[model samples]
Target: MAKSTHDHGAAFRAGYVALIGRPNAGKSTLLNRLVGEKIAAVSNKPQTTRFKILGIVNRPEGQIVLVDTPGVHKPGYELNRRMMAAVHDALLGVDLVCLIRDASVSTGHGDRFTLDLVKQSDKPALLLLNKTDNLADKSKLLPLIEWYQQEHSWRAIVPISALKGDQIQELLDEIIEHIPVGEQLFSEDEFTDQPMRVLAAEIVREKILEVTGEEIPYVTAVVTEKWEEVREDFTRIYCAIFVERGSQKKIIIGHGAQRLKQIGIRARRDIEKMLGHRCHLELFVKVEEDWRDKERLLDQLGVGKEG
Candidate 1:
């Protein structure tokens, strides 16, 4: 047998932390707050997060890779199935699991189901009671925290309001304390690991969600066709919005392309803000009948089939 020596010279604390919760539990909001940036898309609708978004948070102690997962829900379609699988995949190799629950609402089956997943995992778990600011009596939170502590031996119990930024710093400190020492995974300045193209597509998709209502937003997909950086100042980007039918395309385009123009203007402003530079955005509407069901299209859209 050969002896191996472990190298601890470059020891630093860094690991993956997954945020799991029910629909509209403010997981995305919490992630953005922690990272101090809008990396994950946010919407009022349920299941707004369709993928496991990796947000990198750098601190003086170490780096924390936050995985903002899609809201766990019963799948109603193939897309939903893929989204749920993303959530499951994020659980693997996670150092800490922050099970966020809306403090204003009572615990339900959805919360229980996610808690069961955490209970089975060997990873350390933290119960995050979100939306504490909305609660009338802060004293009521103690019982809920006690209930969770009784149900499971959690590593820590934290009450916070992701929207109001209450107790967020304390939560970050707690997470950092539990992270084991290891080498730095990313540079101090790097905020996220996501590529620019993926982020650009997400920006447009988020705009779609913001502009439209009902099932149309869910059926929509944004694809960037070209990205041309002009000199060192600005960039010109072209994208196509895919819909399932001609009727849906018309809805997105609206009368005389008014809706599409609105989406473009808003998406451009957001992209510029995200990139920290001006952008010339061009948006077009296209009908890709049942693209969600098409394996090729789904794969092209980065919605992989493998779990």
Candidate 2:
């Protein structure tokens, strides 16, 4: 694989690009694709992302700081409210805003809601019609792109399939072209702004989302209790998954602790792959009744807290 080379003597271009869109619009997927790594938690469930995730894309042309934000939607609980607030906070000081939308679906209120934010922002905006592969015909993309172009004079309008890696390179080239010359904001080896502890928590949370059905995923929060780098290139990661009630805890633990074991094995594999080493992941399910509604709990969990 050809990696982006950096020229320390030459001027580097770096800026923040916020990815905003409705739930399940493939915003997280796009971020992972652009960074050439899985920096954000991806799930088929709506509102899978709940915070302003920073993914660093280092390319030969420039370094792009991609902000994968929570989906903009009506708030149903305290967590939802925090998610929306995070989205708004991410918009501030952004050099560019990439409004992603599902190209296969007809434009609806959710799409308009996202576009409204773009109109209000002074930063350069780009309307990305994502998931183009799902479209029955390629010609249909032209009209949708044109419609959005007429509605708003965006910096650029591009169609891409994040899942299929279609037109993604073109999208990155366009983004780099817009960023002004500057110094590299991050090291070439760095792929994300999030810390290792946070990443570990997210990996476990993603497993919870995968194995557990219904609202269990949303009600649960994962926190890293201890992370110790052991000898022999191995690490010990202890994490706790918080739930709102005993029943939820049972659901997470499952019969004979089979579900918990599943979450652990899957998370451990991903963590090892991410760290490029072996890992011993230990997960515990605890009932922190109504932790979602508790402000202090939310603060401790690193949600709704300013960075």
Candidate 3:
């Protein structure tokens, strides 16, 4: 919550940049890499990020506030609609847009749809072809680069491997150049804007995504109902995992509630790492039929609230 109030001088440039892309495009990976910390929860599942997470990157010359958004996808339920709205919301105030694409895959209708969203933003953009390390032959990327060039006259096109940190400095340099000269918006030490409670919930959800099958992640949501720092080096948390049906709940619980216990163990480890303290995490599952469509539950869950 601390802002950098001192003047950073005329050489400094700081502004918000939206990392817009399709699902599983490695936007969160890039954000974490840029900020040098794991503030956003990452998984291979589509639409893993449901809110606009602000990651502050401090440079000697400037600061970059990266706004990581939910993936661009066809809205189905109310949750999907709210997720898409977060993407649109990110575009409105950003100084630049970095459209992240998975270079290892073939471009399709979804890619085009994402590009359309960038075009609609009417802001200067840089095309970042993420996951380039997945390519065995780097020369094969020329065609994909050319295709994007023909689609839109971008400010710059940079190929980067977010996972392996390839060409990341070049990408950062390009980003710093595009943003206007201004003072720093956030403290240099502050990496992200997410509260501990929201992050705890996301960590539990990420564990669920990691262990469960395809269908469960889309219908599931996690809310941290309680968080208390019980001691100087220990904390206690109680979280609720809401599913749309009893069958889904059963799957999450597993036989003798083993799967749920595994989720808590994994989540607690990450939470302890983040807080630098031992944590007692209790996870409870509940069936909330059609909860995604319920606005009140969504409000309580902080969906679309960051936008």
Name the top TM-score candidate: 3
Worst 10 residues of 1 by lDDT: 1-10
Query: What's the true lDDT of residue 134 in model 2?
Result: 94
Flag clash pairs in model 2.
none
**Per-residue lDDT for 154-214 in model 2, tens only?**
8777888999998887788778766778788888888887899898899999988999898
The lDDT leader among the candidates is 3
Worst 10 residues of 3 by lDDT: 1-10
Q: TM-score of every model?
A: 0.92, 0.93, 0.95
Steric clash pairs (candidate 1): 12-182
Report the CA-based lDDT of candidate 1 relative to the real structure.
0.83
Evaluation by lDDT, superior candidate among 1 and 3: 3
**Candidate that beats the other on TM-score, 1 or 2, i.e. the better one:** 2
Instruction: For candidate 3, report its TM-score.
Output: 0.95
TM-score of candidate 2 against the unseen true structure: 0.93
lDDT of each: 0.83, 0.86, 0.91
